[model samples]
Target: MSDEQDIQARAARGWRLWLVFLLLVLIGLAISGKMLTLNMQEQAFLKRQGDARILRTAVIPAHRGVISDRNGQPLSVSAPVSTVWMNPQEFDLQNASIDRLASLLGSDRAALLSKVSRFRAKQFLYLKRQMTPAQAVQIEALDIPGVYVDREYKRFYPAAEVATHLVGFTNVDGKGQEGVELAFDDWLQGVPGKKLVMRDLLGRTVKHIRELEPMSQGQDLQLSIDLRLQYLAYRELKAAVQAHKADSAAMVVLDAHTGEVLAMVNQPSYNPNDRSNLGAGMESLRNRAVTDTFEPGSTMKPLTVAAALMSGKYQLDSVIDTSPGYIRVKGKTIRDHRNYGELDIGRIITKSSNVGVTKLALSMHEDAVRNTMQNVGLGQVPGTGFPGEQAGVLPYHAKNRLVERATMSYGYGLAVTPLQLAQAYIPFATGGLTRPVSLLKLERPEPATRVMPEAIANQVLRMMETVTQQGGTGRRAAIEGYQVAGKTGTAHKVGSSGYEDDKYVAVFAGVAPVENPEIIAVVMVDNPKGQEYYGGEVAAPVFSRVVGGALRMLNVAPDNWKPATQVVMQ
Candidate 1:
């Protein structure tokens, strides 16, 4: 009986051990199945979590357009530059590596720390902009947390001060500020693009995923400016301003047929490349040729003569006695330089006689005189679309007393820009057609307005030609190998106390190769202090050099080559 009971106990113990082993195996298989199911279901969620930390949308910068001269010489351009930035929230300012980064970037440790601290809650900040590539490399080598580098463009002016006022400049944000840059900002500015990029812990881009948008670069602008002529005009105008010790000066050169601005320059100019002077004042930044207006002085005499011809009241041979040399109207005296004696209407313009012009103005209806001035573009913008262009002052002729009308005849009581003065003489060169002045390149000459009858325009042009002849006001304006026609002006500079006794504004306007004119130039020298202040003496020489060089440059045929070459005794 004892043996049988022992066997039974042993069998039961064996069975219990086997049962426990089977239960363990079944639990292991159930856990394995659950693990497989969870792995398959959570794969996408895990991927999203990992990507949130490394994936980023990055900006792909676009480049600004280039500005070139008519000959395709570059005036303004953008060059690639590197900028150093940081993620303020991720940056560890207290790290030992922070000092190394500041030294490599040439930044102050305290300043960098303060800047980071100020924007600690923010994710992005610019530490340095427009850094050199070598400096950027040194910064990357430091490998500070959250430090980054980006490629950007900086505006560069190749022409510098040569085209400063016209080409203008851009700001830190690459927005146009002044000049052509400001005028065509919409066309010159670029559109930036975006892309998905994979970045590392240090904010460096490791891989590019896909481009979200394509970048569009700004279109290039080809202006009508001739760089060669621009340099020439700038040099001459600068020299004249210095030699004469004048306050300032301006010059404008136009294509006689197209009315395109070939060259425009001013004195006291500043470099567009260096903006330090901008803090001083904007006086040097002004394009005086277009922005500032001045009394045209005797340059208006040609317009007066043209109007007189248009009215049919005065023939080219019509004679008037200017023997007294002076006349009085409205308690004011209008005088001539000398007794011009009894002279033909043509001689009146050749001499630039104020008394003669006064007589003509008084004879015509006031409205006619006013209409002529207005028709010629006085008191109207030159339509160049330049910033700060002044339309000048033109009072109603009907309201003007006799004296005021007389002053308007000789280019007083009104104001005009150097550009307008240049534009006004276009009819003389274009046979009564007045073309709008253009700074942009035109494919073809546009149709012009008929400001005066063609016959009357030609007759007035003939009379103006004599002004460059012997015994005329603008003899110095005569160019070699060309038939020059122009008027001279020397007006007392108006001061706070009315016209000053010693100061004068010398001005000269004319068309060259008069037989078939091809160039029209206007020059104004303000407050010339030399012994000679007359327009012929002070301003005519500049007109001669510029217009003469321009004609030769264009290879225009000579109209009076023989006489022009001959030396005339002054």
Candidate 2:
């Protein structure tokens, strides 16, 4: 509009433009300086904030120990497994995602959704535990948010039900639950470790930074059981139980010299691996040999005879009159199977004479029979370290009642576990030395305590030797090529009212190769329902087969081999 005025205005506008450009340059320079300060001075703080979102301290699982039998056979072991978990707070619980996860885990869709929704505030929740690696892979393929997989160990029992009662089982978290597993849990458990790791937004580990603590593995254990003998004993005992239609059964085989349990087994067992039926009942989980107790019955006769001998009132040649087949003590009559006019101590034991043994008890000090029983580990724990081992009832009556003494002398008025009964007979097997029972393998025999005089033990052992000979009660216990010394027992089970006439516990206990004793076995059949319920019929045969096999398996030289008849072909 006006050249001169426009010129002045243009000059002012140019100056204003130049001033604005300079101010813009200063602002840019100031911003660049602040950024440089942050990069060099506050870099560590920013890095820490970034790491808090993606870095994590991850757990390194430790491996559990192996359990083995004395022969180095694995009874229980551990295997690698995967556990799938999720951060419920970060999870997107969409219908599609829930359906897919539930289907993959074999879980109900409604239950899975409700569980996630209920614990939405939780940081960690298990989706499925102890899954296979293949299963974990399928889950990870879903690529769902907040899901994670962790490596862990799951217990696997290789011996299955056969060794379950001895080796026991563990929980999903690798904690021992029963038997030797529970008894030695701490020794078999491992200490887990930790490490610094970086993870992605999807809860997957990207990198391991450094280890915080090293994992400590558990120590292995070896039990005293010989698997071979265990299998043999189990097979034979199971057969006997089923054949007899018995309520239950238990058997134990021990090294007579060392007192180490070679084999221990019970009926109505369960598989530790397949625990689907664990909630059914605890009946099958019991170790009857160590946990159950029964009246020892006539099995107590040998010990009673030993008591009489120890009292210096009876000898190997001593005679007792068992006339009229029975005797009365305080209105309680004790009777023999039949009358045997008069018999020596040896014949008394051979025939298992209740009246003879009762006379022996009536004549000695009242405490004599009870003292002999307690001295040989009765009325006390067997010291086997097994969980739930019972100290069976050995009744003590201070009134010195004749009925009590007479009944107690012939193996009544007291209770004993099958294991305790096995241990009690050890003194007779080892010349009166009572070696401590062991459940763990030993390099050598343990020291023994003298429970009775050596001479008395040998004399009693000789008397027992006749029991397995012709016309003796335990004749069925005799082996083809070995001498056996043992006793038979048949006792009526005590009921709520009185001794039950319908229920009977048949038992047989014996030592083989009697000249130089090697193995001792005890067989007990509870409540046999078959026609024959006596110890000689139901239990002695099992002892014979088991001991006969064991003696041959150990290459023990037979002490009673007879000359084979040579017949010429005519």
Candidate 3:
């Protein structure tokens, strides 16, 4: 037990104590590091859950507007359809889910899978569209995950092709494609509603919330077309076209008082319910009444005669030397189908002589003839609401008088739509007052504008009546028991380069029941290829059929028994 031995033992004990303190410190550091790592992992896991889950935005499509006739008969309307939508991320592929969903939705699993795969990254996906209400109900009842039902609207034409030209149809996106639909698309399509919904990690819809104001539907429209008259017009036009074995035809019936289009039909029209049946051609969708322009031919004779008499330029009995069938003007030869020499004004109209009209045009200078034609509603665009309404092109009064005026008198150099001609004749039918035609259904007051004196218009009407009677050019248009006033047209069809010789557009325009005109119908036939290509042969019969059928439908009584006209002096 020496002092040195005691010091050695104490130092050894100090070394042991130092080692124990170091071990304790090392143990404490290990525990702190482990706790930090666990906290970091917990925070990361919560962050991941938040990122994976999201609130999806749901779209609510706007419903389209309705179109109805004056009597509230539905011309066009939208029906509720079910659309199946999917969030590809949510479609958990299960045997029962796939089978049940496919059977209910009438879709193949492969197609559904393909669509979902392509759209998975996208927030919204459409599975199927335009399903009927019953089908929609069946699909919604499936109640499968990721499968949801949305209400959509599909255009329905209850009248089918009856009002095809006026009502038109909408496109796949529910936007109007033509006719009134296209013209009023903005007003017909309203704002859509939108919603924000929260989803679970499995992509299940969990919460729905309103993120903005509620949406509204489009305003309904009322059209001016009378459904009954529309049916009659279509029926008659179809019958005439079928009987004639013609390519295409157009007809229009205007209310004599209001100028509202009571009926407008384009034959060989397509059914809006079946868009597949139609090709995207000018023929399929063209509104012929407003779009197609043709030489008015004999139908224009009344305009010239009326202008002649109205201007105090010529008397009804004034004789013009139209004998031997030709008038030489400015070097151009105006000839006719027959040699009508020394014809009076009445005989000139009755025979529809080209030479007679040329002389009449010459008698009244070029500017006078052009002005009269313009006053009759040619060379102007119809102010109807529909788009694509053509402003019929009238020939410019050429520096060459003979060629221009002669052609103008016979409707050779000018082009006009059937609708334009129909509107133009309104003044003659209603004592020389014209009103704008309407397509809207709401009641519009009949506003008449004085374009000519009532007396002159009456004289013109009487002349037109002669045109339809036994001796006139439009004799074929005479209704058996009715007093009809109309004119026939036989004009060459215009080609790309110029007027084609063989091609023709034949037309007839007139009013029925001479005592009191009720319906004004205009019929046009295109490219009738026959030996006799006159308007009397091609268009007069059509006018007779359409006018007759429409008159019967309107309950218009015939004026034959009443004997309104004078007997022939011969």
Candidate 4:
């Protein structure tokens, strides 16, 4: 029995030992498997961790598109510049070298310290932007740790103040803020790229790894403006504004056949290259020709005449009595410079008779008159895609009081931008056809829509020609060698009070060479302080000078080279 007990205990001990051995082997296999897995992925994981510390992704800025005139003269261009930035965390703000860094960056020591301390938690901070090559080299030679330079493009307007109103200016970060820059931002801005690079402990790039994306330059944009014409207009408008001591002025010249803006210039212009005055009032920045509205005054008479003619109730020979030279409508008196006893339609335009125009306008239906104004693009944006374009005010049919209707006829109780006024005269220039206005160069001149009968337009054209001839209000607008047709407008400015007798917006709109119209030029001189404040005195001369030069530039042979017949009526 003792021998049996001993054998059983031995057997139990032996089985326990075998089971323990199997468990040990299984544990060893699990350890070996985990070790094998770690062997496979550990190096990659550690490499990634290290790379995260030393490798940096750098941005490569793409160049913005060039803005050019129709003649391919660059209006706005991108100049290469360097921006210095730094990792505030990696930089030692307390280091003595920071003093030199501040000096080179055009920053004081205290300001530099404050900037770095304020952005201590930030990974990146711009030290300076748009540094010249020499400026960049000076900073790089200082070799301050964690400071890095980035390449970017800065916009430079070649025409400066001459074209700044139309080309506009950009922000420090290369964003468009006004004018054409804001209008076509997406088309003008470019796509940025990135690259992975190895950096030292101090955040200085040591070696390039690979490009993550390629930068694509923006497309070039060609404007409908002819730079020569633009300069010409600017020169003339600036001279006029300064000569008259006017508050401000604007001028627009359009290709009569195509409605493409050949030149649009504004006075009191600013230099886009110099941004120190950016915070100034909007008066300096606004493209007043398209953005500002005014009571168009007599520049609106042609449309009124066209509407009267369109009604089939009037002809160029239609006569209206103006014996008193003033007429009362709705208790509001409308007057001309003088009371011409009786005037025909042609003589009315030639004399710029307010009573004559008011009588003619009253004879037509309201809808007919309003439709003519609307069809000529008044009270609506010209669809030039220009930023901040105003749709000038016009009374709705429901609100067309007799007073308002009468006032609208003689260019009151309604407002229009200079561009809109120029667009309105397009029908007269194009023989009753109105072309869509554009800022971008078209593949071809846009198709035209007939706004009035050819005969009516021709008759209006002949009347407008008489305006540049004798007895016309716009005689000053006539070029010596060419017949001109346009109306002079002298609107009493409507202020917080009813109407300021002292303030006026003098305007002239005309199409030159009555036989064959090539361009329409509109000029508006605001609040001329001199004694000569009439449109013929202030604005007409500007139109005459600008359009005359433009016609010669375009090489349009003059039909009135023989000299115009003169008829002077005060």
Candidate 5:
């Protein structure tokens, strides 16, 4: 602190001053850094809170459409229901929750515990798919935690077993699986929706943020099934199946002018309400009127006779001698049920003699017959705008075995479905024009193809009318009021081993109001094991009752009047 000390002291004092300034600066910097750190922490906390409150989304299911009949009577519909869902992670299987949940859900406690344990990782699981409002209310009263319900859809078929086959049914996922449900699934399914929402810590949807996508409900559909006629057909078919002890029975009724299907039914039917009894036989699933194939028997003879009349080969009154009840065709004998010594074309159809058809078939060229059959909607499935339809079997026109031709002439070689027979008969019903059958009720009329000459059609119609009269093969097929023109067919059903003797396929196909035939009905019973086996005995009587009911219901006045009874004893 003296001279060197004085200079040093001044310097030391200055140095001390500088040290103080540096200390002050350091203190200021520390204070500034602390404030910055505090501010940064506050900003981070504010951002975290905002992130927690932001919403993302939620999904909403769309509603399904309905299916109704022509008159707007619902056949199938979507029913609103509530479903209870559970989140495995949130569900408490122990404590007070277990007993409460078990009682609320009507589940055994042990089973519920086991089932819940299996869904440990699932954020969401269905406790029940469809629950009634009362059930939901009962469940809510239990105050069970971790359980919630959302609105859902379930299919309902009101007609039940009556219209099951054609209407089909939907599956658990609300998707159409079969029948009309499958066929029109594209138009019947709905689009799902998504929503942005804020969820609570407990995973409950709290606040809606933003809707992500749009959703649309499905459109309703209208089908062309006549419920009244359907019931009648079902009754007739079911009665036939029961009376004949038939393995299966089916029927189809077509409007000759419009070609609309008035009635279609099958026996051994199941209710759509319960698929538990149904199997994958594919046979029961089939609409036999439009599916399975079988020998048409003598019902096919009328086509040959029409073809003959059309080609000018024979007249309605033309004479053909049938001797010894049999006719030889290329070394094969074609025999009728009863022998007729001499007969005309009318008697040939009246008696349904195989020999008479064999003679006519021999007289005609094979090409003409083949072309004629094809023209009559044979060798092709009638396009009825439905799936799983069968085309049926048409034999080779020129069979190596001449017996084949004879058999075909008598409907033994050729095979077809009941639907095909109905369509084929349309030509005769509609005065030589063939038309497509419809399952839709529309104001627009269906277009028809010219299948035969009008003259031939009239002549054939006249001859067939005789077949339902006093001594005709289908004598039992006579309805009370209307003049009915039809043919009876009795054929052996072929089994895996061989032809079953007791099993027969009996059928009656014809048109009513014979002068201006309106309805074309084809009734078929398969593998009837009962005593009455002939088409005349089994199928004809069924046809009579069905056609009679149909005519009465339709208010069709009979050209002549009498009940179609076998033995009406008073």
Candidate 6:
């Protein structure tokens, strides 16, 4: 009985063990099948999830375009720089690395701590921007966790304050802020590129995967300014402003034939590279030659005489009686510097007689006076495309009041920018052709529109030539070997309470080598302090020095050059 029970028990145990072994094999096969499915079908899904943590799309900075003068001199440029950034979420502010970073960046430790704490949840934050590459290397050497450096570009003005008003400046983000930089921002800006990259836990790029898009560099710009002339004009104008203690000053020089702005400068200019004082005010930032306007004063006498000549009512030899030295029109008395008695049209211009020009305006229709000025570009924008350029105030009173007409004849009751005045004089220089003013270099001279007859323009130019001779108001504007043709102007500034007797703007506009004219320039000194505020005394000298140097620099043969006297050796 015991043997049968033992055999039965052993059989049951053996069967149980065989069942356990089979169950184990089934479990192993199920596990192997699940592994195969995951390896084959879900591999891409897993890889993508893993890449989300370490793979990044990074920006590749693009280079900004260059701005150069007419002769290929660089006025503005872009230099490579680095921006120090950090992942605030991963940054350890409590670590000693923060102190080292603050020291290297020249940042306040408290501010750095406060900024990091404030933006602790942010994935990215800028620590410092526009650092030199050398400086960035020192920061990178620290190898602080979460800290990174990005390549970028910083705008640099090579001309500094010399051409700052014209060339302008860019912001920290490489956007244009003022001047030509703002006017042509779209043309000067570049497109940043992107690339796929793999990074480590420290957020440093380990390897580049592929370029998403190629970076497009900005296009270069060529301006019409001649750097040589610009330097000369700047020097002379700055000297005049200092000598006269003027509130401000501006000067513009143009290639008479091409209408290209050879030199344009203003006083109280600031360096674009140094922005410490950028927020001071707009006075230093303004391009006054194009933006500011003033009453043109006696400089308009030549144009009035030109208008009279255009009417065929007055010739160079035509006479006007200026006896008593002053005339009252509509109860407003217009007086000359003195009694020149009777003066011909040419002598009237040479003497800058207010009464003489007023008589011419009274005799003719007001439309004739207004139309001639309009044709010559007065009270117009000058079409330079410069930012904030003013069209100036050219009022045409339909009433045609005698006082208004008389004042307008002598450059009163009207306003003009220095640029407009300079462009207006271009007609006289180019034989009555008024070309569009250009700030950019042109492959060829632009087409011109005739504003006055050639004969009339030449005759007016000849009449103006007497202004720079001895006894003329602009005698100080005379050059040694050049026939200078110009007029002097001094006008009381109109204020809240009418014209201010103490405030005056002195201006001189002229052309050089009158026979075969090359360049035309305008100089304006506003609110000159102390005595000697006349345009002939303050502004005319600047015109002479700047234009004389420019004429010689261009190698233009002087029309008034006399042969040196030869002495025979005894």
- Which numbered prediction scores highest in TM-score against the true structure? 2
Give one digit per residue, the lDDT tens place, for model 1 in 1-570: 699999999999999999999888888988887777767987688789889899988889899999999889999999888899988877876788787787776877897898899999998899888887878888887878888999889899998888888888998778998889998899999999999999998878899999999999998988888888888888888998898999999999999899999888998888887778666667788989898888989999888887787777988789889879998888898888889899888889988889998888889878777787788787898777777777878788664588788899998888888999999999999899998888888899877999999888888888888888898888999988789988888888889999899999999999988899888899999999888889998889899998888888878889996753668799
For model 6, the local distance difference test gives 0.91
- Clashes (backbone N, CA, C under 3 Å), per candidate, total 0, 0, 9, 3, 8, 0
> Arrange candidates by TM-score, highest first: which order?
2, 6, 1, 4, 5, 3
Model 5 over residues 1-570: C-alpha lDDT tens digits?
A: 357878877888999999999999999999988878767767788766766655545667787788887678888988877788877887777747667667767887898889889998887888887777678766655555567666678899998877777777888788887677877888888888987777654445668777789888988878766777788788877988887789998888888888887878887788887788788775567667776788889998898787777667888678888889987767766787878878888788999988888888878877556567788888896776666778887867664556777788778867898888888899888889987777667677677789888888888888999999998989999986679899999998888997787778999999998977878999888888787888988888888887788888878777877666698689
For candidate 4, what is the lDDT? 0.88
lDDT of 6 by residue, 1-570 (tens): 699999999999999999999899899988888888878998898899999999999998988889999999999899999999998888887877777799888987898999999999888899899999999989888878899998999999888999999998999999999999999989989999999999887777899999999999999999999999999999899988898899999999999989999999999789888879867576799999999999999999888888899888877778999999999888888899999999999999899999999999888887878888999888888777789999998899664578888888889999999999999999999998999889999999998999999998998898889999988999999999999999999999989999998999999999988989999999999999968899999999999999999999999998998889999999
Between prediction 2 and prediction 5, the one with superior lDDT is: 2
TM-score, structure 1 vs. true = 0.91
What is the alpha-carbon lDDT for the whole of candidate 2? Answer: 0.90
Q: What is the C-alpha lDDT of each candidate?
A: 0.87, 0.90, 0.79, 0.88, 0.81, 0.91
**What ordering of candidates by lDDT runs from best to worst?**
6, 2, 4, 1, 5, 3
User: Per-residue alpha-carbon lDDT of model 3 for 473-510, expressed as tens digits?
Assistant: 88888887899988888887778988788888888899
TM-score of each: 0.91, 0.95, 0.84, 0.90, 0.86, 0.95
- Residue 489, model 1: lDDT of 89
lDDT of 4 by residue, 386-484 (tens): 998999998765434777777788888889999999999999988899988998888898878988898888888888888777777878888977888
Model 5 C-alpha lDDT versus the unseen true structure: 0.81
Question: What TM-score, to 2 decimals, does candidate 4 have?
Answer: 0.90
Q: Considering summed lDDT, which 10 consecutive residues are worst modelled in model 3?
A: 196-205
Preferred candidate (lDDT higher): 1 or 5: 1
